[model samples]
Target: TAFAGVDPGVNESGSYAPKSVPTSKRGSSNLRKTLFQAMDVLIKTMPQDDPVYQFMDRKRTQGKPYYVYMTAGANKFLRIYYGRVKEYLSVLPDPS
Candidate 1:
């Protein structure tokens, strides 16, 4: 849901494809809102050594807008969630 909601759309038609990150309105509004809020808290409270914090800090230094950085963080959060869940499921015994 976060992936659907937060990821940018690709434009593949033009000779020069300018990269853009448009805020998508295609997924669960509630989930998107919650993720955005969670990211805000994490950004404020997470230590500098944390990778998400480092990513956000880099974006800040690069002059990305606050909301853009927050959305990127949410996208990162979803990818991490998927990876951990996949790993956990892989370790579980199969049902007969």
Candidate 2:
């Protein structure tokens, strides 16, 4: 999430937190752009069983802005991707 820069930004001071937070945007812009494009496809295709699409749709219905939901969806996508990859790697035999 942070690696892709889709993680939400943290803006806090002493004991105050803003009502709204934005993406950190500290990672590869190309990656972020690609993820956003993927999200657009998901929105258009409307895959009801896809968890990422469901999450984005839920956020959209809740009145969140386009970018907010898209970024959240991208973050969710990366998390799912990471988990699957980790699971696959764990089952591979050691090269040694």
Q: What tens-digit string does per-residue lDDT give for candidate 1 at 1-27?
A: 434577676556769776774775677
Model 2, TM vs. native: 0.94
- Candidate 2, residues 1-96, lDDT tens digits: the string is 887788989999998978988889999989989999999999999999999999999999999999899999998999899999999999999999
TM-scores of all predicted structures: 0.82, 0.94
User: Local distance difference test, per candidate?
Assistant: 0.79, 0.93
**Which regions of candidate 2 fall more than 4 Å away from where they truly are?**
none
Q: How well does candidate 1 match the true structure in TM-score terms?
A: 0.82
